[model samples]
Target: MSLEGLNMLWQLVAAVFAGLGAAGVGLILRQLSGKRLPRWIVPALGGLGMIGYQIHYEYAWFDYKQAQLPASAEVVSTETDRMFWRPWTYIVPLTTGFTVLDQSNLVTQEAGEDRLVEFILYRFERQHTDMVSHQTYLLNCDAREMVPLSGDNREPRYAELRHVEGSTPLFQAVCPNA
Candidate 1:
């Protein structure tokens, strides 16, 4: 199984444990109160604990993933959004995704007059299931153009080629000497 799958499985197990623990607390409370607490309180507390754990896990994911990255991986940008379903996000926007540039694997080449740099970009998104995708890119310092390379052959996707500003973090990281 993929790391994400394993993480999800662990999360499910943790939530179940949280619910069980909260239910145990509820049982103890009832016992101490001469059984005056409603019979539904135990299950209600269990459900609350599970939901609380899920919320905390969702909010903590970005920081957890960031801490897992290598030293060479620099976060270029982050995306935040407020979802209608997640009302609390409107108060404090949730980090939905981020882009990381791997500096260690950068390959610089001289193709005649142009300075070409090939690098990998890692994109991480928070969804129902966390997703991570990476793609190889070729950047021409002289032309300030960037293009994604496709497949094992590493052929440039001309259709997706676009201009990149020199001041962007990606450009600065890949073409610092340019």
Candidate 2:
């Protein structure tokens, strides 16, 4: 299992505990209300709260990661959608998939004066179970650029890379030896 898998596992465990805690709260509320609440109401409310919290966490995951990630991290790709079940998502889009690259983990090479950098790409998909895809790439970081290498069937899609601010970290981190 990868770090992301471990993170999701921990979230699942926390959700269960949160559900139970909500049930406990319901019990306390029932007691405070002189048991006017029906026996099933407490369990029902707990279940709803648990599911709501899990949904909220999953929906907020992209924003959470963006906030927590290092400044050197770059969002290479992203997709969003309006989930019908979550009406609020109609106004605010939800990330269904994304790819992020960390500048710190790159290898460098030089073709004469031109610089070439190799690095890994981490792709994430949100679904029934969150999934991660890993690939590698070799980028030529001169005024004109090309991806000389990449893992799997994937090739680099972004051609106007040199103009992006994120490319600064990428070039700096990858071209230190050059």
What are the RMSD figures for all models against the true structure?
Answer: 2.9, 5.8
Angstrom error at residue 129, model 2: 3.2
Query: On residues 1-178, what C-alpha lDDT tens digit does candidate 2 reach at each position?
Result: 9876898788888888878888888898899999998898778778977887777886788887678668877876788998788887788788888878888777676789777677877787887677788767676666434453443665665663334233454455555443
Q: lDDT tens string, model 1, 1-178?
A: 9887898899999999999999999999999999999989999999988988887887898999999999999998899999898788898888989999999999999999999999999999998787899999999999999999999999999999999998988899999988
> Which pairs of residues have clashing backbones in candidate 2?
none
Pick the TM-score winner: 1
Candidate 1 local distance difference test against the native: 0.93
- lDDT of residue 32 for candidate 1: 94
Task: Give the CA lDDT, 0 to 100, for residue 19 in model 2.
Answer: 83
- Give TM per candidate: 0.78, 0.57
- Candidate 2 achieves a global lDDT of 0.72
Query: Model 1, 70: alpha-carbon shift in Å?
Result: 1.9
